[model samples]
Target: MLKEETVRALEQTARQLRVEILKMLNTAKSGHTGGSLSAIDALTALYFHQMRHDPSNPKWEDRDRFVLSKGHAAPALYACLAEAGYFSRDDLKTLRRFGSHLQGHPDMNKTPGVEVCTGSLGQGLSQAVGLAIASKLAGRSARIYSLLGDGEVQEGQIWEATMAAAHFKLDNLCVILDHNGLQIDGEVEKVMNVGPLGPKFLSFNWHVLEVDGHDIQAICQALENADETEGRPTMIIARTVKGKGVPFFEHKASYHGVPPSDDELTRALEHLGHS
Candidate 1:
């Protein structure tokens, strides 16, 4: 249940995420813009409104954990973590630079709030399952959440982890698929065709929900519902645009891994109400 004011705050936070993402990529001159921007709303809602995390004590034993399976979206995660007070926002400019804590991919040892080093894709869910299983064995109630790219789900390992999580009745684990439809090669349908995704998760013995990935309230509700569900892992198949919010980038596959140019970044910030 999200209060109206909290909803407003989340909207503001989403805008801030977009601004930071543009600024970070603009500074780094490399990284995935489409996927990161598309996942911003979901990431913002989790870090600001839902997850049980401590900025000061990132490794707190009882805190909820998040694994960004689609680790190429590290820009969005870094922005969310910084806004949540995990680290100073100024570090954003150092992304992908040598000796910077903010690397191209998240490295848990180097970055303060990153829970896992996940850039290879299709592996975070398995790691998340292990974490959830450990929590159950330790009698801790912490939940583990993983965000996967829809394209990454094409890998065989994803379904293996999916089966493992359900077989073990890891109800404390929730996975969100960032269904932005486009991947680096092309549209997911053309790349590998992992459609019927909602039913696919249901058939795998997991509870399934679908939501607009850009809507913070809907994202929160899906997460809340996942928490209440019992006896199985939950998956939220979030439908999103490849590049969201920016006029030129939205639904465009070319921007999948391309940073916006200086002119493009300026226009994007203006579109996001930052200019």
Candidate 2:
């Protein structure tokens, strides 16, 4: 169990990151808001607690790698990266703007902390598998982590990667599915059902675990369990709400690819205690 103080601190950090994500999206006027907000808590737990990364030495050879498989949630990753000191938080305002390193999707060549280029869905897991294989071959202790959307899992390539990860016994790899229930179109079940994820991953020979995505302690505990498990990759199905912290946006599909408006931004900031 995590210390109460530590959990409180992480929760506070996540709330602050939520504020940042809303601000970034509202400024860009055209980024995914709901998914970004939905995934912030998990991303926050990983960057602030689980992952071994150096902001000043981002290229450090032994550091763990994080891939945002659902790259439309780039705002969430960008906020975490900035808070981790990979870049200036001020740069977050430049998200999705022309010539900004923080583009609509993650670019390895552009972003300081991003491990791989991920925009097209269903590809990030494969990249993470490759990185895990490389780390094993190189005898490095670096672990590879990736986040995928429930809707994004509808792609066949994800299954292929799932099979490959098990075949290779990529135990150093951990993938979190951001099961936020809704995508751009509508509810995941209504659009294209992908439930019972635990059994599916288990059949693929993955060690499956489920957790409340917004609970920092639960997330951290699951991550720690992943670290201990051997001979199979772990799939953490994190159940989350679409738009987590904002009252108007929560679970609303309309906010998926839409940024907050001027008035919405003001209300959101006030709700987040940002003033």
lDDT against the true structure, per candidate, is 0.93, 0.95
Worst 10 residues of 2 by lDDT: 188-197
Cα lDDT of model 2 by residue, 206-236, tens digit: 9999999999999999999999999999999
Query: What TM-score fits each model?
Result: 0.99, 0.99
Q: Give each prediction's root-mean-square deviation over alpha carbons.
A: 0.7, 0.7
Most lDDT-accurate candidate: 2
lDDT of 1 by residue, 1-275 (tens): 79889999999999989999999999999999999999999998889888999999998999999999999999999999999888999999999999999989989999998988899988999999999999899999999999999999999999999999999999999988999999988889998898889989999999999999998899999999999999999999899998899989999889988999999999999999998
Model 2: number of clashes?
A: 0
Query: Given candidate 1, what's the lDDT at residue 33?
Result: 97
Clashing pairs in 1: none
Mark the regions of model 1 whose C-alpha exceeds 4 Å error after superposition.
Answer: none
| Model 1: how far residue 13 lies from native, Å | 0.3
